[model samples]
Target chain A: MSQKKSSEPTPLYFVGIDGGGTKCRAELYDTTGNLLGAGVAGAANIARNGDVARQSILDSVKAAIEHANLPPETLASTLACGGFAGANLPSASNALKQWQHPFHSFYFTSDLHTALYGAHDGANGAVLVIGTGSCAAALKDGELTQFGGHGFLLGDKGSGAWLGKQAVVHTLEAIDAIQPKGQLAEAVCDHYQAHSATALVDKLNQANPGVFGELCPIILELAHHAEPTAQALVKEGCEYLSAIARKAIQQSNGALVLAGGVAHALQPLLDSDVQAKLTSSTHGPEWGAIMLYQHGAFNQGANA
Target chain B: MSQKKSSEPTPLYFVGIDGGGTKCRAELYDTTGNLLGAGVAGAANIARNGDVARQSILDSVKAAIEHANLPPETLASTLACGGFAGANLPSASNALKQWQHPFHSFYFTSDLHTALYGAHDGANGAVLVIGTGSCAAALKDGELTQFGGHGFLLGDKGSGAWLGKQAVVHTLEAIDAIQPKGQLAEAVCDHYQAHSATALVDKLNQANPGVFGELCPIILELAHHAEPTAQALVKEGCEYLSAIARKAIQQSNGALVLAGGVAHALQPLLDSDVQAKLTSSTHGPEWGAIMLYQHGAFNQGANA
Candidate 1:
C-alpha cells in the first residue's frame, strides 16, 4: 500500500525564547526532545525597546529555525513559548502578543518563571537571579511566588547594577575626601578616566545599566583581593541576596539555585549558611523554555 | 566728593545668591551688610539645568534689586558671590562666570561651603544639609571639607530622596507579599494609583528625583504616626545622617548645625550624641554667600 506524507499538524518543532533588556535568545528542538539550534539577537524588552522588540524576537526565532536546517514552513508548525523581561506587565505582554507569529500555539511568561524552571529542571524550587538586575522566585506545584524584581530604580538590592552604583558612590566620596581612597576606588576613577569628582559625576550621570554593570567585575575582583570598600560592597550585596534566598526558600521545597551572569562572582561572597543551600541548575533557560512550551502554567492562562 | 553720581566704581551694595537644584534665592545688602531684600526663582544647578540656570539667577537677582528699590545699574556696583549646587564642577562654575552679570566682582563657591559658612557665621564649624538631597560639610580655618553629596545616584545616603526610595522599595515588597503591607506602603500604592507590583515598578522606572522626593514628606508623616515601614526608613536615614554628622564633627571645632528644608524634620530623629553637637545657624545661605564674597576660599582661588 502506498501512502502520502503525513501533514496533520504534528507539532514536530518546538521553540523556546528567552527575552531581556540586553538581548533575546531562541532555541529550536525536534519532536524527540533533542536540541537542534540556538540564536541570539538584540534586546527584546517590549517596554524599553518598543516596536523593535517584535523584530528582535522574530529575528532570533528565524535564526534558530534556519540553524536547525529546517524549512521555513516548519516555523508555522512549531509550538513556541517565550519568557521575557517586562512580561509581568499586562500592557507589555499584550503589546507583545499583538505581533504575528507562525507558531502552532504560543505562550508568554516572565523571565523569572523560566529561570526558576530551568534552575530545578521543572521541579518545585527557588532561584535568585542577581545580574545587571536582581530578582527572586520560587516554584510550588506549578505556581510561582515572586520577590524583589522591582528594577534598578526601586530595588534590585544585590544586583550587579546595585554594586556598580555603590562603586561609583564610593569613588565619588574618595574624590571628595569624604572616604579614604582605596585600590578599588582608584581603579574605578581610572576606569572612567576621571581626573576630578566633577568628571566622574558627569560620566556617571549619563551611564546606563550595562555601563554601570561593567564595574561589577572590577569591584568583585577587588573584593577577592581584600580591598576594604570592595569587601564591604560585596558583603552588603551578599547579605541582600541572602535575604532574598531565605524568602524564596520559604515558598519552595528548599532547593535553591543562584543563577545569572553575576551569580558565580557573588557565590563565594555569600554567608556559609546561604552557600550551603545552593544547587547547580539542571538545565539552561533554553531547555526550560522548551519545557514551558510543552507544559507551562502560562499555557493554561493562554488557552483559557 | 560725590556731589553727583560718580562714574568711578563703588562697592555700595552687596549681593548674595543661594542656588540649588530646585530654586535660586538672591539677597541684596547695603555696604555695611544689612539685609535689604530677597527674591526666589526656579532651578539654578548649571550642570543640570544648562542656560536656564543663568536665566533663573538673573531673574532672582533682578527681583531682589527691584525689591530693594535699587536701580538696575546698582547690580554693576555690587560685590556679588554665589554658592550654587554644581559650583564644585569646573564646567558649571565657568559657564556661570560667562554670564554678563553687572556685579563689580563675582565669586563662586559650592552650596555645601555656603551651608557650612552660614551655619557657623563664618566661624569654623560644620553643617549637615538634609533637604531633597543630603550632604555634610565642615569649615576649619576657612577651609571646607565635604561628605556624602554625590547626588541621588551615587550617595546622598540619608536624604529625603533616600527615604523616598526606601519607601517605594518597601511598598513594592509588600505588593509582592515578601513583606507585610502597612499604612505607609498602602499610602505609597494609593499615591501612585498602582494596583499591582508591575504598575508600581513601571511608574518608578520613569520617575525623576523631584517626583521621587515628593514621596519623602508622605513617608515622614507616616513615620510620625509610627507606621512600621516608614519608621524603619526614617531610622535608617537618621543613622546615615548621624554617621555623616560624626564625620563632619571630626573636621569641625565641635560646633554643628543642621540645615536645609528637611533638616528640622530629621533633627529630633538623630542620636543623642549628634543632637548634643548641634548648633543653630547664625545666618542663612544667602548671608553665607555675602560672607563668601568678603572672605571665602573661593576668592583666594579666583584671585590666584
Candidate 2:
C-alpha cells in the first residue's frame, strides 16, 4: 500500500531511526532543535530475519510519528534518515526500499555510519560500537574505515556477544572438568535458573544468538560485584575493544567516539587507556542524522 | 591392627606414592632401580577429607605390600614417601602419623613439592601446574615459593578449570542476547549436548566442579581447530599462567619446570610463549617421592 499527501514544506521535520537485530528505535526533531518524539519496536536487522526486520522498522517509525501527534498525512513532506543493520547488504537495502511511506525525502545508511555520526557530531573521528555485536569504524575527511563486525562466527570482538560467548565457555568448562568451579558458574546458574550444566547445554543448542547473548548482562552484574572470573572476562573484552580503537586511530588519526547500548554500559571499561586515545561523542546517531540533513548531504528519495 | 615385622631390613625397599584427590598410586623400587611392584587406590588427600585420609593411606600401603608378596612379619625396615593434596595443611601431617604402616620411615609433603622435584630432580627451578586446579611454584635451595593457588574461587588462572568456566559463561550470555553466536557457543552446546541456553542452566546446576571442569578439553580441541574465541580463552589462560611463572622466576631467579597432568596437556600453550622458560619433567610425582626418601627426609617425619 502507498500513502501520499500534498507536499507543504513540513517545517523541515526529520526522523532518524537506528534499527538493529533485536530492537529498533526512532527519534524525530524539528529544525528548531526541539525533539518531536521517540519510538521503539522489535528487531529490524533484515539480514538476520527479513520479514521481522521490515515489520520492526515500519512499526518503530509509525509509532514515532504517532507519538509526535502528527497525522500520517503530515509525514508527506518530512525527510527521514535511517541507519539499519544489514543495510550494508544490497539485498537488505533493496528490501527496505520496497516499503512505501508518505515522506518527501528518505536516506539510508549502515547503522555504523549513523552511530559514528551520532558519536562525533558529524566530525571526522572513530566510534566503537559494543552492543549485542561489536564493530569499529573511523571517519577521516568524510571517508570511513572499518574493522571487526564479521558477525559472531568470524569476529565481533569486544561486543556483548563476545563477552557472553566467553562467559558461557567458562561455564561449560566448569561443568566438564576442563575448568574449575567459581563465582561465574554460580552466577550463571542463578541467573538462568537452570538446575545443572546439562540443562544449559539444551538451551544453548535451541536458542538463537539474541536469546543467548541476553545473558551477558548477568555477567556484567556479576563483574560489578567483583566476581573475579566475570571481571576478568570484561577486562579482556575492553582490551580487545581498545586495541581496535587504537588501530582505527592509527589509520585515521581522528577523534574517537563510543556508541551502542553496551558501550554506555561499559563506559567504565574504557578507562584511561582508551580515553587517552579519543574523545567522547557530543550527540548520538539521531543527532548525527540531523547534522546530515542540515548539511544537505541526505536526500530523502534520491537513492530509492 | 598393628603388625610387627622382623628386623630383616624389609629387603631395603623404597616406596613412592602420589596421593591425589582422584586416585593414589604407589611404586616400590629396589636399590638396583628395578620396580618391585606397584599399587593403586582411591582418593587419599588427608587434608581434604580427614575421615577417609588415614584409611585410604593404609589401603594403598597394604595393596603395595601385598603386590610385592612381602611377608608382614619379615618387613624390618622400609622408606615410604608420599605427596598428597592439601599436605600444606598441618592436619595432613597429623593424619600421616596415624598410619600404622610396617615401614620403618615415612614422609609426606604437598603435591606441589613432589611435582617440582619430579619435574626438575630437586634442582632449583619453577613449575606451573594446571590440573584440576592451577598453581605456580618455585624450588630454590630447598625452599618453595608459590603463586596463584587460592583455590578455584580466587585464582587458578591458566588451569583447564579456567577454560571450562569461560565456555559456560559464553553459552549463557549468548542465550541472554548479551553475546552473538560463534564457534565457542557451538562447541559448548556440542560438548554438553544441550539444545538451548535454558538446558545449559540445568546442566550447570546439576554438575559439580570436577564434572564441569571436564569440558576444558573441548576448548583445547576447539582452539586447535582455530576457533577465535576458544583460542583467545586459551591464550589468555596461558598468559596468566606465564605471568605467574615470571613472578616466580623473579622471586627465586631459577630455571623453570612444568609438571602435573594438565601441565603436559597444555605444553603447546606454554611452549608457544615460554618455551625457553620451561623444561618438561623427566619424572612425575612418584620419582620425587623416591628422591625425598633417598635424602632421609622421610625418617624425621618433620611437621612443616
Q: Which pairs of residues clash in candidate 1, taking residues 3 or more apart in a chain or in different chains?
A: B76-B102
DockQ of each: 0.33, 0.01
lDDT of 1 by residue, A175-201 (tens): 766578889888998888986766887
TM-score of each: 0.73, 0.49
Model 2, range A18-77, lDDT digits (tens) per residue? 887577898878768788888899987755677887677668777888999987775666
Best by DockQ: 1
Residue range with the least summed lDDT across 10 consecutive positions in model 2 chain B: B1-10
TM-score: model 1 vs. ground truth:
0.73
The numbered model that scores best in TM-score is: 1
Q: Give the least accurate 10-residue stretch of model 1 chain A, judged by summed lDDT.
A: A1-10
Put down candidate 2 lDDT per residue, B221-277, tens digits, no spaces: 888899888888888888777777776666557767776557776777664445677
